[model samples]
Target chain A: MNALTTEKLTKAYSTKVALHDCTLAIPQGSVVALVGPNGAGKTTLLEIATGLVKATSGGATVLDGLEPGSLAALQRVAFVAQDAPLYQAISVGSLVHLAEALNPIFDRDFAIARLKEVEVPWKRRVGKLSGGQQAQVALTLAMARRPELLVLDEPTSGLDPLARQEFLAHLMNQVATSGMSVIFSSHSLAELERVADYLVLIVSGEIQIASPLEEIVAHHRVVVCAPGDLDGRHEIEVIDRQLDVRFGSHLVRTRNMETLRGLDSHATTLEEIVLGYLRRAQGIRVLEEIGRS
Target chain B: MDIDKDSLPTQQDHPSPISFGLDLRSGVPTYLQLVQQVEAALRLGHLQVGDRLPKVKDVVSSIAINPNTVLKAYRELEIRGITSGRPGVGTFIVVAPPTISTKAFDQLRSELVTGWLRDARGVGLEDDAIVALFHSALSESMYLANSEGSRSESDGDA
Candidate 1:
């Protein structure tokens, strides 16, 4: 069963459509990257999946057929929000004790071990620790529960480069050891490229590409076509097109290799693929405005 | 002198049959990195026919990657006839990599390599610089070839 599946999930706040007709399936035991810019509905989608927010239409399921937001489902899923939420007034030891008291399956030893592994002071107050330390503490607490699925929202946004690496290393170690399934959203493509096996590219509340990272890289290419030749292509989805006014050259997504025939095409990186989708989204917005006028 | 039995070498103490690694900064896809590592080991004679590969679980846990990535890399090796899996057991190196033949061609290739090294040295290129330069050049040329191949194939289709 999928770790999480959303079917045409839609969420709107008044007139602002946060997410629209979004359908995605995150497989079990895969580290999936939910990628987008800051305001591209990544937070809304994650919130709905965790049941922190309600979907105006459609639904999301967690871990084989459990209804999202249900107590049973919530028990099996752990969420580490952007700002790792913990009681700042309590000591690190108190937080662990509180977690143990609250979670039936909490592994106290494991939590303590994780903290020690990261060298987080057990005697220190949560309020006094650095942002990285607080994030680590929150992660350690969530991991102690031994949840079936872990969802993180821009987990390392506040961390320095070295801290981010260490954090990801710890998370990767856990995933390797426990076969844990994870879904994390991040704007940092390089980090995502390193850790994520699956890619979910979301732009303007829509999922443009969702597949294994290797498959996405294999199927997508950038073709530098002779000017005026790109207009007649209907064999593949054109994510975006750029015209080099100085050289009269056209750059377009090959979508598949079929349209790349007789054209100069090159393999693209994850960043380039994402930028193409974002550019295309911008183009569509511009067209809509033009039509309205 | 006192000798510790634990320090003694045994059959199991020999170097592992297969050692897999990846460079996250290498820009090569993870699965391809795995495949390339195995192929390099085979070509360098570090691995032999019938050598057992590390279990999928071992690779995943040690490297902290998704299990499917290891599986995909293994599948690619299998497809190339370099390795085979035994279901309940584990994957094994089934054959040595194909070797280059023809002494004349080898001599010519070695001469070309020597000339390139000489030219690189003349330009005051260090070992790392030489490797980087070669890799960049190869990738750039391969991209040109790749696009050319695609263009021809599409033309044929049309």
Candidate 2:
């Protein structure tokens, strides 16, 4: 199959298990976002796929031409590490040139122009620029590489809201223009709602779901009702809910939102869907007992 | 990831076969859109058997899809005998494509309709209510498609 497939991949850290029997088949050139909260193994999984960390058992292969860590693989697969590491003395312009020269797929003109679009100065040293600017420069290097699969770990971290928006817009525009696959993991759910095509939700060490981001949003919804009588009757575990006799709302997951018919609806987002999954994975027994009781 | 609408090459003729803005975000896949567009072309006779398909690259460039995705759709059409590929030359629609048997289209139709209906059903709507909603939604979509086609036609003429 000309796809990225991980067969029975397992990873563990001593007695602390992280990613148990996780296997996912991701096609080439599909922008899939890996999302989970802190310590959710999102970073660990990305690290293994990049060959920075070895799998405890099973394996991840990237098509036939590439193997994790094979120079060919590294050349083709770009990793925008959580915090872009740049030599403190390097200027943004020089780093761009360095990246362009090193990467076979580098599109310097596009990268330079994108930086110009963000109005981030080119001559600023990595150490001299603000945090957001550093993030942008890091992102610019990765995008310029134009790899087949760009794995971005917290690509938007440390940026203000506006810079984050700019970064996301640029990331999506590049994906559309280049047909490159991106696996971007972020804590920013609202921003993720805007650009993600696919979502991978991992909690504690297992992938609960991976599907088109839109599908996740569409399938999961929240229904608000005056809290009190309904809590006892909800068949599905409450993902997160607060009911002050004055007002109440419940976030829950169902394959279909048609179950939400009569409730006064409130907000629904992938963030909720993911958090609920995490909660269940962590306290699945408690949730089941609640439901059974 | 800066998508400069102006920076990318723009070769598509205006009033293209597919209109973007006219459609609602129906949450349908692009291949399905291409499938529906081809069917409409055949029904309207704007396209005929032996008509060459626009290059996969061209289709991908115009629509936000991967080249492989366009190829996949064309491959499905070819398997159905609605289209044929001349290796390196492009895909061409074959006249008298394998029996579309109205039923062939029905399955795809039901799938799309059910996507919306299934969600409504999940919310506890009755079958009759879901059916009514489907009709309303389908009519809305058809109206949008027609308006979009005409708008694009004028753009092409210009």
Candidate 3:
């Protein structure tokens, strides 16, 4: 079943359109990374999905069929905003109790057990815990509700590599154990490459690409060919071609892979491929063209 | 993930566990590497039939490899009778192929190497010379990436 769907979803921030008539189906129990450059409307899209921000046009649906922000929907899709709002004065137990108090579906024992797994102090207040620990507590509370959809916004922005891994690990473990679908946004291609199943690559408030991660990595390669070897090549589309005294190749992204090896070089990386798509969407495809669709 | 830094191990931070180069980088891709690794592990007896592999989520978090990639590998292996996946119970190694082993990877690699051999012979490159050339190119690529990394580190981000 499509756990969430946006039908021509559009959102505007001031005169600038933050999202322009985007449409997609997100299957149940899958993880989607809403990827884009900064200000690409990823945050705007997530906000609209959770009904924190209303869409200027179009509509969204959650679960089999439901209003985007209705209480039933809200109860179904729990959110952990990038700036997780936790009461500093409330102890970990108290904060969980808050969720228990607020959510009829709250699973208290599971929440406490989750905290125990992470070594979170039961008696300590949110203010006393480290940034990571607090984030973990907030996460426990979010998961405690056992919502069908969990959306995390720029979840690991300032986290060090190890902490980021742990956070993601815990998140995915919950996903596996609970069969919950997750959609989070991030600007980091490498991280997303390693974690996400599906992706929506947004650029300047438009959905540039949305597909399974495998399809992406399957296509697109960076081919390095000598200047003369390019031969004004019409076979494969090149994204970034530059001449160098040593490497003699340009970074490129393309769906056509056969011509890549024939171009006299190797393929690029997961990160470069993502960057190439973003670059193409911004520079080549006009925003108006995206909006019209 | 918003977590304290000290609570976790620095990435690959181990003095180095017994790991194959299941790289998080490269579009050559994680699942292919995973397939290769598991196959190698089986041949070396590092894993055996009926042994439960790590939970899909555990692999995703600990190694930080893409879950889709892991799923792809697992699915393909199961199809090939190299492994079996039982929903909710995790994946397990299949000691014996329910049928014949295709040895497709071996055949394909051999065929490609043969083509490379013919090309080198046509181009007057010998076996040792070809081997050296392959190593040199691999090393060059590695060097370029590392050099590029250090240069970026020094230029301004420092």
* Candidate topping lDDT: 1
| Model 1, span A143-262: residue lDDT tens | 888988999988888898877877776787677667788899998888787788899988889888889887677667766565566657666666666645533323354534555555
Return whichever of 1 and 3 wins on TM-score.
1
What DockQ do you compute for every candidate structure? 0.19, 0.04, 0.23
Per-residue lDDT of B30 in model 2 = 49
A13-40 in candidate 2: lDDT tens per residue?
8878878888888876677778776887
10 residues in a row with least lDDT, candidate 1 chain A: A246-255
Worst 10-residue lDDT window for candidate 3 chain A reads A255-264
Please tell me what DockQ candidate 1 reaches.
0.19
Who is ahead in TM-score, 1 or 2? 1
- For every model in order, the TM-score on chain A comes to 0.94, 0.80, 0.86
Candidate 1 per-residue lDDT over residues B25-102, each given as its tens digit: 666878889999998998888898878787666675456566677888899999999999887556888897776778
What is the TM-score (0 to 1) of candidate 3? 0.76
Tell me the deviation in Å of residue B46 in model 2. 29
Which model is ahead, 1 or 3, in terms of DockQ?
3
Task: Report clash pairs, candidate 1.
Answer: A261-B154, A262-B151
Among residues 3 or more apart in sequence or in different chains, the pairs in candidate 2 whose N, CA or C atoms overlap within 3 Å are A19-A205, A170-B1, A258-B122, A258-B123, A259-B122, A259-B123, B15-B152
Question: What C-alpha lDDT do the candidate models reach, one value each?
Answer: 0.81, 0.69, 0.74
- Runs with alpha carbons beyond 4 Å of true place in candidate 2: A1-3, A63-65, A221-268, A282-293, B1-158
Q: Candidate 1 DockQ category?
A: incorrect
